[model samples]
Target chain A: MLCYRAWVETRWRFLICLTVMLLPSVLYFHELGIFPMQHWTSDPHYAYGLLFGTHLPSIGIWTFAAVFLGLGGLLRERAVGTSTLTLTLPVSRAHVVGTRVGVGASETVALALAPWIVNSSISLFERTPFSRAQAGWCVLLLVGGGLVYFACAVLVSSVVEGEYTAAALMFALVYGIGYLADHVSGFSALNLYPLMSGTRYLDRNTNLFPGPMPWLGILASSSASALMLLAAVTITRRRDF
Target chain B: MIAAPAIQTSSLSKYYGRTSAVQNLDLVVEANRITGFLGRNGAGKSTTIKMLLGLIRPTGGDGTILGRQITNPELNRQARAHIAYVAEDKPLYRYLTVAQTVRFAAAFYRDWRCDVAGKLLREYELPLNRRVKALSKGMRTKLALLLALARKPELLILDEPTEGLDPVMIEHLMQTIVARAAEGTAVFFSSHQIAEVERVADQVCILDRGCLVLDRSLDSLRESFRRVDMVFPVDVVEREFQLPGVERIRANRRQMSVLTSANAEGVIERARAFNAVSLEVAPVGLRDVFLAMVNGLESAIGKEN
Candidate 1:
């Protein structure tokens, strides 16, 4: 039931993000080709890299939506005078926060998959070879890597009371990281832009595995997300309604 | 076996930095009775209620509801299954329709009564599909009440339940409280409305500046508290009348008025010893007792400053 309430509160934002990414992918594929047509079929690595780059914006958009989903806890409820009613229910604070986080995370994963679904549909209709493994890797990397921003949103919403302030702070942090990653080589691996470090194109001509995956960066991002989520839950548990 | 207290607190305090919101409030509300928690605005009435429900953590002390420790989150959640609370604002989800609101609340507990909910929905004339934000204040209040009453909770706590209610609604609300108590549900309500408190509350607890000033059964208050007015030919110092049982003493020239909460007879007998020309004793009403308790504290604080 709490999940239902969370969905009711967040479905519009999720749908908007999904539509924002889905329509653009379909349209981009439908329109006249900007790059050569042979690039898509002759070199699968270049095609995958191009696809990954085009869908990078979707990660940022999903992060925005996830932030909004995380902003519906006691502070927001108190503004509407419903916090008392909510807290009085026979449910623990952990359950309420857990349900909201779970719902928001689920929506985030689904949003991450929207572009892949659109690309796969286009590939099938056009009779072009689509790598299931590459598509699966894209979805996995986007979700796993993009969770850092989602967790940042949850942590900000847990602490900050005003909606605009929390959102603004989250955007600043995300954009600030983007700016730092572009300027500094050391932070490039941590850059969530370009979607999964823009790998799958180490050699543009061939799709062969010579270098190992960026396991350290992936591990760092996943751990950061978990830490931020745990912080949010701890803060919420200690708070008064 | 004697029934246990529906609610009990020991030194329950909430402090906001240097200021105290509620201070060492030791209170007991017995089972199967309507107890009115009376206080002036900002007298910690709402704070105490919030603490009892575990909506907020206490800064210093703790309480229990239905024998479950309120400070423990798990225990409080367990206790809440049997508690129904209506906040002062009568809050409901404005985005949900009235019917959906009812359905949402009913899904939480195993003891929800659809029959009572249906009866209240009809009597209130609440449009099932009408959004909560579109409803009038009175209708919103009724919807909140319906949600609470339909559960038939073991304890019902309302804060300022009749604050903006009309006379008819107030009367109906009072009757509902009495009916709930008759069904063996302990009702604890906080209000500034003394008349309603006197009419419905079996016991009254008055708080002032985070401290309890009075806690007694209404019948005992009526029997003990008295207003004794006296006229003296010669002027008498205020300290002369500060004997036992004297709560507040007001003096103007040769006129002296005294309010006493206990041993009224003894206080009056001493007044005669001062060679009073005339003396009058009147029974203390709840309003007068409440005013004296609150005003007396104000004057004391005023003198300190």
Candidate 2:
């Protein structure tokens, strides 16, 4: 029921993110007439890249969603007038944070899969071939890297007091860090924009399918997400309701 | 056998930077009784309760609730499992319906009593399907009480339980508290309402400016505390009546009023020694005792500042 509570609290934003993430893929399939062209003529590799690249908008929307989802835990429950009730529960603060983070991260993974699911349906309907392995890899990379933003947004939301302030601060921090990663050669691996969209890795080889996955980037981004969540838990534990 | 106190705090102090909220407080609340925590606004009643529940960490000192140390998070969680707390505002999830809120709260505690929950659901006439935000203030209070009472916890702590409640609702809530106490649940509730506290509380602890000024049983307080008003033919020196039990002494020309919490007979003898023309000793009610203690503390604090 805790999970249900978290979902009910976040379901609206999740729906918004799902719609925003899947619309472009659905629209692109209809506009390009890629269905009739078939797999051999249409170049599924480039089509896959374009469809997945549209993930940038989804990622942007998801960063806000992640922060908003994470906004109402112990730290912000004060604004909602439920902090005392939440804090007094038998569960530890860490468990409360864990449930919230788990629910939110799951929603983020679902958002990452939105494009894949949409594209796959279109491919199946058109008898246009799609690589399950490539689609899985895209989801893996996007969620792995995108979760860093989600976790970072969680961290910011945990610390900042106001809702809009936390969201604005999360956006500024994400884009500010992205701006640095874009300009600095040493920080290229840290850029969330292309990392979430699969565009940065695609620059080297257009064929993301049957191609070597960005395992190093995935490992690095996933580690960062873990670290941010740990920090959030620590902050929550030390906080006095 | 004397069981361990349901709650004990020694030198438990909470200081927010420069201001001290609760200072060097030693409190022991016995089990199987309704203990009323009475204080004026911002008198550290809620803060003390928060510290006891580990909702807030104490800056200094320690406490134990149901023999579990409150400072340790793990231990506090263990204590909270058997402790039902209704906060001052009686906060509930606004997004959840009354039934959903009950279900969500019941999931966390192992001792949740479904029978009591169902009974309260009907007794309060709370709309099970109505969202918490949609409930009236009275219904919300009832719902919060229902959640706590349903737990049948070993210890129940409620802050300002009857605040903003109608007289009938307050009476019903007091009855429920008394019923819980009768069932051997050690209930600690804070309130500014003296009459309700006097009616239901077996033990009363009064807090003034974050310090406990009076801790006594209601019956004992009524028996031992007294108001002696004497009309003397001559003015009496205030220092002459400075007895061990004298809590306050006020002289207005020939008439002198003395309040004391103990040794009332000694006070009467002292008044007679001063050749009091007319002497009347009255039993101090809980309301007057509370006012005298808190008002006396306020005056002393005022003088020092």
Candidate 3:
């Protein structure tokens, strides 16, 4: 846990990006004149409501934070030669890698739920209905996206040798997948940007408007994440360091 | 008669793609002795140490470290716990303070001696609060040794632990190694500092170009190899000064320094026949032995070429 905290303190870019991710939702509520008091509800002008309404885009924030933070955690130690010290410990390599991944995932989950909790609390005073299941599902999808992104970051860190090169490669991957998903119809399944867009079954009646539910995309992403994690563990176990 | 050797390798070989880094390495590090692994740059010292620690997979043969199989990961981990390794580069976490690094190392070993760590920090006068990156090269090496020593391991594998330090620090490091060996911890370290090794190590292994050229006890080494200093008469011819069993001979004016592999008797006989005025045969130390071996290898290679 101290390792995680130390990493977060050193990695200011990750903190800045996380702040930027939350800014849109916070500003959306403020723009609608319901930030401190009422929560953003379904408005007559916009069918999809504001970004922080029942259809808040928490998954996007979660995925971005997870990928950025996860890569930083895994790569910074190696870049600074701390991984050599970490590996020399009596603990198994798997345990060290798992602890780092677990801490990164935890941070992603916490960041994902921040806006939801704030909105839910304010909705109580604003006389707007808050569905606990809808928020929970949103958090779950964000976690799933985070898990996938975290696994991808771990794999990238293992394969790339240098710090700057690995980070550049990760950025390229995130943006490349997102750009392709937006333009190509078939590639959206691979895009991690719109994590909860496929889960329409859970948000039918609520003010939240879910997009086309692609079950195959969720299944594929989950499987890829599992495989990436397995590969990372294998590489770590067999590595010479 | 003797306790089982703490570390033994037989016909161990490791290859990096097409090049062989360590070939047919045979070594036996006995219990309760300080062994110095002496070698020139790229002499396979680091490669052999890595194989002994099971860090790199050996291409041929195997060895036992602390009575455990080398290839087995679980046993390797267990064996590693009993032995402490300080790498050649003295690599450490730059972001962590000295105290944090010590604590981090303590978290792994079951028998971590925090008291020893504390004592060493005080004894060495290390700044525990300073970040490792802020430390000087010598300080980093001390902290690395401190981390390894705090584990109370039975065997300590140090690779060039004192490569770049002042004479005072080198002497202090040698004293610390001697103190540790006195406590019954077997210390095996590599160094190019022959005088330092001669001061503390009982056993010496000399490596040259990925081969173990010389391995012997320091006492036996001194007895067998001798440096004979002789002053030939001014009338004696230089060509007539050549003697059998002489490994190396260097002369200036009337004095000739002959490094002989034979005992003092043979060197004396040759010196007398050459009409030498004065002859002194001094016992050879690691420095003499190392120079002889390296020069011998270079000459042999020169001849081959």
Off by over 4 Å in 2: A32-35, A38-42, A179-190, A203-206, A209-211, B297-305
Best-to-worst ranking by TM-score: 2, 1, 3
Residue-level lDDT of model 1, residues A209-238, one tens digit each, is: 244555666678889989998998899888
Instruction: List the DockQ of the predictions in order.
Output: 0.80, 0.82, 0.33
Q: Could you give candidate 2's per-residue lDDT for residues B1-305 as a string of tens digits?
A: 99899999999999999898999899999999899999888989999999998888999999899999999999999999999998889899888999899999989889999998999898779999999999998889989988998878899999988876788878888888988898889999998888889999999999989899999999999888888888889988778888998888777688777888888788889888888999988887787778777786234223322
Name the 10 consecutive residues with the lowest summed lDDT in model 1 chain A. A201-210
Query: Which pairs of residues collide in model 2?
Result: none
Docking class of 1: medium
Query: Whose DockQ is greatest here?
Result: 2
Mind giving the per-residue lDDT tens digits that candidate 1 earns over B1-305?
99999999999999999999899999999999999999999999999999988888999988899999999999999999999999999999888889889999999988899998999899878999999999999899989988998988999999988866678878888999999999999999998889999999999999999999899999999998888888888998888888787888877678777888877787678778888898988887788888879886234323322
Candidate 2 accuracy as lDDT? 0.82
Score candidate 3 by lDDT: 0.71
Model 3 Cα lDDT, one tens digit per residue, B1-305: 77678788888888778898778888888888999999889888987887777556788878888888776667777887878889888888777788877877777677689898898899777898999899998889889888887777888888888876667777877887898888888999998878888889999998887778888898888777877777877744445545665666666678767666665677688679878899887776577668768775233223212
**Displacement of the residue B21 alpha carbon in candidate 3, Å:** 1.4
* Cα error, candidate 2, residue B198 (Å): 0.6
TM-score of 2: 0.93
Global lDDT of each model? 0.82, 0.82, 0.71
Candidate 1 TM-score, true structure as reference: 0.92
